[model samples]
Target: MGYSRLNVVIRADASVHIGMGHRVRSEVLAEAFSEQGAEVCFVVHASCADFSKEGDFVFGSESEWHELAHQADILVLDHYGYDAAAINALFQLNPNLLVLDDNNNRGDFNCRWLLNPLSLRYSETVQFPLTGGQCAQLRPQFSKYRAVNPIGQQKLLLTFGGTDPLELTLPFIKSLFVKGFPTEFLLIMVGSGVQNAKEIQDYCRQHHMECQIGVNQVSELMAQSRFAISAAGGTLFELACMGVPTHFIQVADNQKDALAEHSALGWCSATDFTGCLPKQRVSLIDKVVESVLKTWQTDLTQRSQLARECVDGLGAWRVVETVLASRLVK
Candidate 1:
């Protein structure tokens, strides 16, 4: 409730099902708005509230979407759980609708602003009856990020998003330990989709990689880490903007093209997961550790610079302004 005049509402959700990237990005934009003197309220499904990214006033009820929208100058939706009717419900009450759509599924939303950042590889995900310009690639608001300070090469960040369903995170940590990678401070981010917290705990003890699971302060961890081993989803952009060198894993087919395209451009490295079994995936962790340390030892300056240039930030800020501008025009 930092703003005295405007109330901005962000409706997004994170689950073991939809994954954490959705909420992570939503939080990024909402926190930015909060710092700019906006009272940001988040409307989410009750079951998904506990896993939601921090900050903002929270409303955990599906029936509350329109009600919350009525109180805001802008409504930002970043979840796939809702379809056209759910989204239109909010739009019916407010002229401004900002949707963070992946897959370009809702390419036709009747809204003021629509974000299809980096475009969507899974066309069916957003090729819906919704009407709005498909414009997710309109640049991000990384410059407007509310996080302070930066990671001066202390720890390594590992985030595989929502499920970590493959149980890949802790296995990788053990590989790092076996390979004797520096364990001064390792921050591991996972989602409820992963039921292996206990296993992660035991492995961390065995190798003592200062790693933890299910961290809520993921941005803070990214800001603190020297580099990252991440799934090629939303976090890729965040890591690039943070200037953290990254090695990517495609956890799903939905993410294949983005990962491959970015890797080919040297924005990051891609480890193919197609038809790769779980045990085989574990072995790849060894390759990741080896590759990471080797890259650091050989040429780091070029890597960091590349990452910084790929995502210069400001995406969320641009999105917010776009929505607001559309509202003003009407």
Candidate 2:
């Protein structure tokens, strides 16, 4: 926890418009940076936002172009809404800025380091019209904070979002119950920010589907599981890296492409939640859960390959090491 002082500022252009991957990955990156003794801060757009963090200097409202950049050795931008002008708005004040993007549109960025660690399939998404110094193309690195090598029962996690605001869990889990599948526990990680946690809990109890909401002990719970059924986003990467084989379901449109791609490669099975499922939602969940269970049991070989290729569990460390080793101040 002790090292050289590092003021790392991250820009995440997230809102109700964008889903939660950017902020989530940014937070994970910040946690990695913190492990190396960096003081991390995040600059978010001025909107009705609920995301929060400790030791995080939250900047917003007027979108203060604070001299925090001058203090920070690294200014990493993970936003999607911001184009060159938006990046320029911040970077003009601090010339030594590094941008981390996946969409591959860093057009004429004064970027010292341009990172796109996505796989070859995703390369097209990020292959910009222009070019710059490619950033650290990382091997998969699992999170140090998360559970490693399973020590307990299979932790089945169902995290749609920090806030599954739709109250979709009851119908979703009820569908699983109707299937009468053999499974130990189903952990439903929820954010209190979402108002439907209570409704989800009562429904879980009624159906005898073991469920727990609230964001406590998730990483540990996930580690204990032999397999996971989760949304295809940053969590998919984390689960694969942790060696927790997953039955991935895309809960959003953006996730569908990634899920399909990752599933095609045997990383995770794709059961999407983005379409109209008639009026019979429970029936659909049952069908999906059954499919997930079947694939999870018999598809170990593919899953193992997926675990290897997606993330070897060292990506966090590698990125941090790159950040530290690439320090210009030294």
Q: Give the best candidate by lDDT.
A: 1
- Estimate every model's Cα lDDT from 0 to 1: 0.65, 0.60
Using TM-score as the measure, which candidate wins?
2
Quote the lDDT for 297 in model 1.
60
Q: Write the per-residue lDDT of candidate 2 for residues 177-269, one digit (tens) a residue.
A: 666554356666665555677877787777666666665445666666667766565667666666677776666665554565566766567
Alpha carbon deviation, residue 230, candidate 1 (Å)? 1.6
Candidate 1 residue 164 C-alpha distance from true site, Å: 2.7
Mark the regions of model 2 whose C-alpha exceeds 4 Å error after superposition: 1-5, 13-20, 54-63, 105-108, 120-155, 183-185, 275-286, 296-302, 327-330
